[model samples]
Target: MYADEICRMMVWSRGTAPATHDDAEHGSDPLTREWLVTNGLGGYASGTISGAVTRRFHGLLISALPAPLGRTMMLSDLSIRVVTPDGKVYQVGGQEPWLDETSAEVIDLAEFRLEAGLPVWRYEGAGMVFERRLLLPHGQNTVHVTYTLLEGAGPVRIELQPWVNFRPHEGALDRPVAGPYALTVVEDRYELASPSDLPPLRLQVQGARAEFRIESDRLRNVRYRIEQSRGYDAVGEFYSPGRFSLELPVSGSVTLVASTEAWETINALSTEEVQRAERKRRTRLLLAAAPEVRSGPPAELIFGADQFLITPAGRVEDAARARAGGDEVRTVIAGYHWFTDWGRDTMISLEGLTLVTGRHTEAGYILRTFAHYVKHGLIPNMFPEGKNDGLYHTADATLWFFHALDRYLTYTGDRETLRFILPTLTDIVEHHTRGTRFGIGVDPKDGLVRQGEEGYQLTWMDAKVGDYVVTPRRGKAVEINALWYNALRLMERWVRESEGDAASQRHGAAADRAKASFNQRFWSEEKGYLYDLIDGEQGTDDAFRPNQIFSISLPNPVLDPARWKGIVDQVKERLWTPVGLRSLAPGHPDYKPKYFGDLRARDLAYHQGTVWGWLMGPFVDAWLKVYPADLAGARSLLAGFPPHLDEACAGSISEIFDAEPPFTPRGCVAQAWSVAEVLRAYARTARSAG
Candidate 1:
């Protein structure tokens, strides 16, 4: 969608400036305020709004290991000191937190907000305004920090310090680079090439005479409280290559472009130019998805969604292999900070992130990218992290693929893309009916999909540690059966829409049998809600959970309207929250309200009662279908998210929230489906409103 066209479609979605959190105005905590900017290659630069590198993931240049796999944190931080005309020195942001306990209290920034997708800062004091801007251009492993004294009392002197390191995001820096580490000192720029195989790190302050101290200093015991809370390494030391001192005249701007690419490409374009381009890209996104939404989606949600979709630039191994299959894989990284693209997440997020957003090209590319990975009538549960082979432990990621495809076909009307994957889709039906991975196959007793095993965690409720399967819903899971029924019906329509189908008669029959069996087996008159799982090892675990909502939410629902009212009321009364649905109801014994502690403890609560933001999409879908007129109530559910953007990741949604009151946000700071679903629901409401 072009910007002009987007403007026409988007009744709102106007401002390009990021929502602001000005310390001078509001005085928020330094550690609590964080910002994120990603290069479309799956690499990102993130830190707090106060400019302190709090998390190990906080870095200026965390390069995508190759393209989109194992990510490595290259540049740790930049320590900036500003000098006024009167020689008054001020910290650009905050220094290492433990350097001085009082430093955070003293460090005060003027203003901070996101401009387009980039992070921009303004230091307003001493009768002057010094602006700092960060831009991570799409598809490039580069970080650009442009400093311009927007308004100054007089000529000011600025001294820049860069704390650089090369470590895996999970690991922390140990010591300074060996003396033998390659260093190229020049008049305008300085480059550090570590002894390790990591990319060469370079810093170029364009239009300034670079002066480096060339001292290898260690800043130790920098505390990462967020990591510490998660039972991970919370403190580490960073090796400062050196500190550079330079002067900027009043109204003069100089950009420090750091990249893995050659020094020339780093300065190829101006940050303002990059900023303009990014804003246009964002505008198109809002506009393209405008038709999906009513007054268009909020700028925060629209911009937040842009962070997940990236070019499928995976780790490339050999030149021959690269040539055989180009690294031009377009995909949506499941979440920021830790998640890679998972099959289930990718399919569930497709329509909202791509089709609804008017990224038809990206949508088609993503579908085809997954299409290439289908095996034995199964799509991978997740593309192996940092590896080529994909895991196929999941029983439903393949089935969800059909619904995603059907959605794409409806939105795009792209016959060629659908035709290409038709055989793969048909093969999935055959494979599921017969048998596939785990114990997943159609049960002859009911014709409903039944899946389970000793250790395999097949459904999204999957949270395993060693041999312990957390939610081991190892039977006729309600949602999986719902998806299976939906898939069968989808295949029937897929055949009818694409090819005048004689070979696909089984789809309709299969759908009918699954629906009848689903209603018979899943329905519970005693409970007044559908069973969470039927015929499991434990024999019909009729727990109240949000999972059964999907059965009534899908386009071709297996549940009748009478059943829909019961399920809807049950979910609303037991599981529903403002942001999302709780994994388990409060009445359930296993339900844990808070998500915290070590891995095992956290896993126990992961699905037990955590409120999932993504589940809101299905909840909204089910609500609208059941009521068909409570648009106000449906809209109110999503209205809670706009404020959520201001709280956690700043204009993005968290993967999950605590089930208890004040429901603290947790998990991936920026989640794909969380953002996608809200946008989709907003659009659905907007269309209804219009």
Candidate 2:
């Protein structure tokens, strides 16, 4: 997911098809679709089932109503039953169900029923109604749905219906097509359509609402039309594949009918099918392992409205929906709620967004935006929404910003832009020298920077609860010092090329001084590891942490080869997980595995022992930096990344993972940093292989 404050629509096509108006109207067709159906407008969809039981699958599901306007309706009644190709009947799973602000609550929803022989489940609701049957032959199965709406609304209109199409691409799967049709709003109307003719699309309307006769006809190729009474507004469009145009009256209600043609098609494709397809394609190219590595299948998930995207700046609306909703075709076009002046996301999102998918412009924006925050020697932790507020929690975001800037310069070679930010970079170093938030002041004795104790999180694993610091190192963190060392080196290098001999000499001396002091103070021979942090008293914590990864992995190296190898081995044995690099080692007294539950339990596990996606960047980099450059070894090390990239999520990536075994992808499913890190790692590996 590319992280940038500004977002725009991107369209890509193969061959020269002579750019035509048809692309604008229908968005370049056979009308492929990838729908990310969630119950709510914002939050993530839930698909987890705890404990075992039977009855029917019941939950609050949400899909965009098949209308012209882009509006969604709640699926209050959702029940499904499963039966194998054999004669055995599988128990349905739906218990006490309730719709909350962002998810469905199912109480005892998975009880095993004693009765057998082709089980079926019935679903009834106020606005919409349906029934699902289970246990049919394996190859193809028919699904039936009955729909009805309330009275006194207006004419009912259905437009651009869904259809299935085939793709000729090597790995292309079946695709859903959005037909061009329109519906009128009306009261008490019956509508129906089907993928096959085995059973006539069934419709029954009987209630207190006004009733209208229905006229249904198959017209113009595969298109179908249903017209009812006229009164309410009728608006809708089939946006692409998985999306439909839908609009509803402020006061009226509408019933939706849903069924798929093939069971395999249903299982193969999701509302986010297009986005998933794109993810598979990109992951294949990015994964260092096989040419065929793909994400896992789409998991059936649903979310509600009222959820918001959480960022350092503040919560923003539908920031990740494009990716979650399956609209992410290229670089998961993810948005942030706020982009503080320091541009926290800008630099951080680069590895995931640009390098992974090769979206460099997005990378540039991240650097430029944060450079905007370098005011008076401070690169803001974030830029507050609709204000000039710049929060400075991170002592190294600015330093990392310089590293990213250097990278951007290497990629684009825009020396003018590089020169433009040089002054700001100098200001940031100067500010750290003076002093800032927490107690991030310079230590004159050793020349190593001293960061004070603060409540806010600075580095990526920053977790704080109320007044207690979760993983506070107090004085100076290992990674921050590593970044500081890199920053000085970057400045020295930049000064030589852009500012000539005198500037380089001045910065070079400072870099040497800082480098010597950093090595002397942070290296720990007794522990055979770098100290996690150094406080005002210069006390060191020898805990196994990920912070030291940067001391060896980053582009600029401050640690000797022996120390780098030791740190890498220690981290690998302690914090490494298949899903990601853990925030802290499991053996730490504070480590906890249960990451889901109430706020405190979750937060306690957050940075204490959780695995983070972004940390994979430094881990991979450090591993390669320390090991002898064996192409086979590097490829073998990177092989684990592809499955996570292609599994079920399609083009999107998760935020964090469980620190322990079965490291289920948890936290946000489509995090900016995760995408950025994956992209950067993929690019690094790909370039090496090339």
Candidate 3:
């Protein structure tokens, strides 16, 4: 059975082809289908497969500042022109004129595929072949564009004009770039500085004779239709400091490297060499995290898991550890195309992204990294981009941290880690028992965690639009209490293992009380499942939601085993789709059908009825827990995500899907927990098959 799944998953090697456009509609919008490549430092190069920009985030060099601190869009596009020996000029790669318009297929695009996550575009026509490839080095901000000339394609000339920008990823530039760019043409290279402080961006043409035209021009009114629909500034302006025209030889390759400071080192290496080095580096890291490097289906998942692991800026303690020859700090970005290193995402993604992948060193670093930022016993809900301190609004990110760390210890038996984070764990328990941010505290009477505030969405179902807080699961949300009960149990076990007698006694008593209270209030004998939450904006929100899965799915199950099957059955009966579990059941009046339109429309559907891939992990966990004897059922559910890997973002899982029939992948194209949770569930399901 595993072999069959592995055989089916081999589609990742060929990847998905770019959808052809017969019209300018979104169904045929070239920019609607995108591809991305990241440097483990949180920097990435992403654009449509047709080489068009659809979002402000599209760019060739989105540099990871200092160490995944923030991202900046530097090189917007490299318009490529190819001249055949017969004097016929071919604009194989240009801005919207060539990227989107079907009339621009004069070059006759032959093929496009993601070879090892690298986007490759091939154009063949008029007895000439032009192939464009894009890759970002493992830990560098450089975007390498390689043009390989096939034999018999005739000797030709290739010109590259780079559109440069210096701005944040989310912003748009409507005016011309300010003066004093300090453009320079040196021996065999062209350099330009957007700012005085940032290193000069080096442009190198490998082995081709270069003619530099030192000039500047603004390409105005470059519109992003996707952003327009999202109700954002859709038009932008870009300035190119210069262009490079180079003479090429048949059967030869020329690479243009756009990078800061690394060009001096990378200029000597060919594009093939860089790709080979990157592949080797990625394989090493992937293997380090996942020792199970068998030629099977999970290999594709391991590849997906590697996308979220980034080398973040080391703190003072991390620098000290590095100086002492200890491991460097690392964290998981929540998703691609937008999200930063979120605390809730990192903690929830820990097991599958790190532990199951055999990344023990990174697991230790990630746990410690978040522990360093624990404020008042609450881990941050989100670590805002470009800053050190994080926002502490979550009622569950702190609790999720406990579950993540406990799983880490279970997988590695790292006693040293337990001892190290003991104080922080103790503080979390005490703070939650008393109170933390976002009105989060353990009720003294019931010992269950209660959290919620007017106008604040504290749980994972967080979606807000100005004054409207979507899914404001106010008090005693089902999943928060489940995580709360699990965290207490984890603390009790950690204390016992670490030989903290007094702490163990205290945590044990707390865990027992929380579980007793959880069972008493959460279960609904009439509904045959758990209540979604108590004391919602109204009274108790008995609306069927997948959140109840956690009561049985977690490593530390809080509900009685006798009632476990009922929760799983309810979720499977109503919320379960072929893709994932819906946030809300279908019969509810508030349940939304699809996630689309502007901010308000999207947010309304977000937690109301959108399907979440991450939820499947818990759903599967609950499935197996209730029916440990049902391996077929577990395997059947695990098969749901493989098709999704190819749908939106090749080789990665999407964050959420539409709730109605014909579920379409939506939200982030590559989400961390989406991929991680699916991988984690796959492992558990596979274990039962074994």
Candidate 4:
């Protein structure tokens, strides 16, 4: 099963090293490259290839706690030290203190690679070779750290020092978890519990002899270098319960299971069995995808796409509500490290992550899950971390919901689910027709939906800092109206099917009015592109932003076909980059070539000129509309992404990048929509070209 896996192996070798020795390759620094492993309940383990904890979010275990607590980091790190028969001790992981000049250094990190979606590292020292692999068992809040003596003499003594912390994953370093932590041990198994309502962290060993030594202490001033560079509170303090000593012989192996789950769940499967099951599960995902995309970049994305589709375990109420309704609650986490499930990102990513991957049942579950949360004619803009209820402030996510449903119906021909949710859809359209929260409604004057309110960021360009909305886009946003027109057309068609044309006449007439108004009002005669927003707070915004691409990209394009070529060409000439379309054109006065610095600085440039990886999906759709025969050209536009899977976050895509050359990857390491849109676009092109 593993022999022909396209993205299964990524080796980083220092130089002309042996087949067993792997380090950074082609001057590509492994220190900057990161790897992630996720449990289907919104819990994950992530860190740099160099073994440095660059973010507070990096941990061996970040468990998802049911509502009001969210995700909590239970295990910060576990450093390994190897002592051979030759009486030599070497630090195998990395430096202890992030920036301590005198800290013991990692002697020889010979190699690093991803073997079957697992992060593996090899170290050679003391005439022996040691290899370590990390895995997070599916659907459980546990992480398995397995060690193998790939090449060695005999009888090597290994010391494992486990550091612990109890805090919200997004906790600040200033408020360190000063706790009276308790450590309980019962002959080979250990449990570390906090003073708060958080659950205990269980630790156990398998496949080797082990001993636990009680050495309670604190590792202070451990700096997260990446966070420091981002102008955040980078210094953190962690608690240590003790150390474990284990022995391994030639070709021997050992496994350490660290989890917050109960003992039964933790001991449910042996480490070997768990590994085999996970591998088989990933294989099934690849097989489910379209035949043309069963290998290469698309194959890797099949795994990447799976990382975002998770059960909302933290939102217990939502889960109960869903179960009562005979459905499961599945949603897409917007991105890794910080983002929760957002309505817009989920709907935008649904087709790529679920339908295209051929997990139609889970796809239906995700849509129905979001449907259960629809309120006030709006789907949730986002669910706040640690909270059960969602915040309904967006103007576009609900409309995108309609588009997602249309895609679902087109793919599965499932009329049953549509019939079930038709009332919800009808209610949404009615609310938009009259009005909803955040000043979102159809303007009778032009039949275009307008959205905005002081102190609110309604559109996806939404970036607010300290009560200041960066790109408020408080008006009839081009994409919003395009989505509006699309939604109206879909509603018209759907109502006609469910009922008759007489019953859908209102929706049909509304669609006609919106389409006419969209073409007339959005087209910029002099600029050769659509206006970013019409009837804005400060009048019309003629910004050359990528937002206008949606005018021709949706299933039901609002823009007239006569002007598509001009829009596509203008976008390609001014906003196009190999990685993605620039949010704002380079020549715009507000354009910032780089996205970096403190929160305010990053926010200002976020929607101004940052290159969004997800925008490539829309650009390809628009491009294909303009030049239907240029499938190769459309495929070439995505050439920059295949190599990118090895960067930022190994085997996944980034949220955004710098607008200029080098195009540094930024924002969340593994973004849901970034992987979704790329996979969606690549598969679409492959299907058309084939």
Give the candidate number with the greatest TM-score.
Answer: 4
lDDT for each of the candidates? 0.75, 0.45, 0.76, 0.85
lDDT of 4 by residue, 239-354 (tens): 88777898888899888899999998989999999988888888888788877667788888888898899997776677788889888989889999899999999999999999
Candidate 2 per-residue lDDT over residues 14-98, each given as its tens digit: 2213213211111111121011222112211122121111101111222211112111111112232222223222222232121
Q: Tens-digit lDDT track for model 3 on 1-690?
A: 121122221111122343332211123223355677888888888877666777788889888775333687878888777767777677774336723323433554556665545567776666677777788877777889888777445578877788877777765555455446778776877777865345677778765777877667777788876677666777887788777888888777778888864555766567778878877765665556444433344566676777799886434555576447465668899998889888899999999998888888889988887777888998888866776567888888888998998889889989887888899988888888888777889888888888888788889999998988878888888889889888877877777877767858888898898888888888888878888898665888888998888988888889999998777887888899877899999979998988877788889899989999998888888888778888778768867676665566666788988887668778888899988888887777766432
CA error at residue 589 for candidate 1, angstroms: 0.8
Q: Candidates sorted by TM-score, descending order? A: 4, 3, 1, 2
Model 3 stretches astray by more than 4 angstroms: 1-31, 67-69, 93-95, 98-105, 173-180, 195-198, 262-270, 289-297, 314-325, 500-503
Which ten contiguous residues of candidate 4 have the minimum total lDDT?
18-27
